[model samples]
Target: MAKQHKIIHVDMDAFFASVEQRDHPEYQGKPLIVGGQPDSRGVVAACSYEARQFGIHSAMPCARAYRLCPQAIFVRPRFEAYREVSGQIRDIFWRYASEVEPLSLDEAYLDVSYTADYNGSATLIAKAIKRDILKETRLTASAGVSYNKFLAKIASDMDKPNGLYVIRPERGEKFVETLPVGKFHGIGPATEAKMKQLGIETGLDLRNKTLAQLTERFGKAGHYYFNIARAIDERPVRSSRTRKSLGKETTFAQDITSVTELTTKLLDLAEIVLESLAKQKLNARTVTVKVKYSDFQQITRAHTLDHSIALGDLREVIPMLLARTEAGKNPVRLVGLSLSGFDAGKSEDRQSQLDLAFSDPF
Candidate 1:
């Protein structure tokens, strides 16, 4: 007899806002917003469930969010602080599974099929982890348990803000068939609208379409949709994935035409990219500079480094890359800096280093 596969998806609910509330008791039970400043042409990063009552959501303009919930507490995001909490939660995950794939700062998938203790079932493990997270971080996490990645991800979201849902292998297919297409992870607003236009509004609608039909309409994505509708997912929880690229791009409040102004923007972009690389503990062998002109024309320039270069190195290189461009011909609307071709270190390597260095020796 083959062994059953047990996959778990963990997601932090309203991560940023929840973290802010947890750290500041005064903000508890209030409509808290974590994002950029309202006056700085910023957007809401995340809003408490309370704020959602006013129809506020992530990426909504801060000004609009403020107008909707004028009494809501708006605060800028602190990535470093969030990263600290994330690390603590990750450590808790490591205690249960060796194979953990973090989807973002606030979510991850874990494969515990090869557990050393083999005590209890997957649901028990999920429950225990959630309890530990709440006890340790004073934060809530939702857990989804299932036989495959797709089902596990969906199950986890079935209930939110410290909820847990499970889909056993025998019932996985039935569960998936009844799910709405809009509930699927990759089906965005655009895709859902297109699916509706085709008279396809549910998983059953998607399942009714032949692979050829779906592929014709959605290209490669169509095939993926078909497979997911059937609850067929083969992706594994990968723990060794590394940072693929480091990049920064900025949209301007106003466009600039002068070479000197473009150079200044490029320099700023280089610094931002460098800071990201340092945080990720990565060095890149390739440098890519991208520019979008006010006319919406886009161009890119790339240069390979003889050795892995640091952010400081990029500060010097980006100006040279900008100088090489024909700047006077077009006014620049956006500038971006990207670094690819990372070395062997894994994505969490730098984070682990920081954790180790900061721990007390007593």
Candidate 2:
């Protein structure tokens, strides 16, 4: 029999807002938002727990967030400060587990299946990591422990804001039975709605569907859904996954038609994409512009250069790409900028380009 894997997913509690509140004592326990100003055409990058109580969430328009809670404090993101703290947290991960897969700056998955620390108890190790993080950084973290990544990720969210929840091997399938299909990590909003239409509201509802039935509906993702419903996930915790693309995009609360407004938004996106590239020390030869019209029609225009793209290059190329589409003439609801052609030397069969969803409200 194959041995079960032990995985722990650690997620920081309201990372950006918590960091801001920690730095400014006056902001503690108060609703705080980290993104652009309420007056600017920006979205909420992150919000405090207090802010969430007012029905505010990330990717919401700052203007709407202001309307939700006029007393909420809005501030720009301090990426440098957040990165420093993330590095510190990563250091703590290394001390506990040799295999750590970081999903983002504030969340990671650690495989402690073979670690003898805490007498090989993944649950104990998770607790220790959480304690160490709070002791060193004065920040709270929530953790989920389970035998596989799928359940582990779900368990992490069961109790949040300095929580540690565990799903044992015996209870994994049972735990998923009552979970809403919408809460499953891989199922997005659109998929959840479709599932609801098909009467797949919970894991048990999904589990009742035969492999053939599910495959007929969800295609390749059907296999994943079928197995996870039974609490079986064979995927390993890959420590060397490479980032293939980095992109940023924003959805406007109201559709925009002005060329000047579109250009301004593109420039803002470019600045953010450039900063991410500089931070990761990466360069790309391909840039793709995504435009979604008010009618929900979406299109993309791409330019591939012989050399890496720079700010000056974007300034020159973006307008030309926009011209290629009917962006200014058409009312657009979303605009995206993506950088690809990262020169990771892996074989084509082994390589997959993953697009990082843009969460920076522009």
TM-score of each: 0.66, 0.67
Worst 10 residues of 2 by lDDT: 353-362
lDDT of model number 1: 0.79
Instruction: Report the lDDT tens digits of candidate 2 across residue range 1-362.
Output: 55667889999999999999976899999999999898989999999999999999999999999999999999999998799678668766755664789999999998777665666788888998998788657789999999899988999998988999989888989998999999998999999999999999999999999999889999999999999889888888877554556766666767999977898898898897777666445678999898889886789899999898998999888998999999878899878787889755444422221122212111
lDDT of 2 at 269: 86
- Mark the 10 consecutive residues where model 1 has the least summed lDDT: 353-362
Pairs of colliding residues, candidate 1: none
RMSD of each: 14.9, 15.5
Count of clashes in candidate 2: 2
lDDT of each: 0.79, 0.84
Residues 49-137, candidate 1: write the lDDT tens digits.
89998999999999999899889999989898799678668766755664789999999998766543235367887888898788657
The alpha-carbon lDDT assigned to residue 146 of candidate 1 equals 88
Which candidate has the highest TM-score of all? 2
Clashing pairs in 2: 41-362, 43-361
Stretches > 4 Å off in candidate 2: 241-362
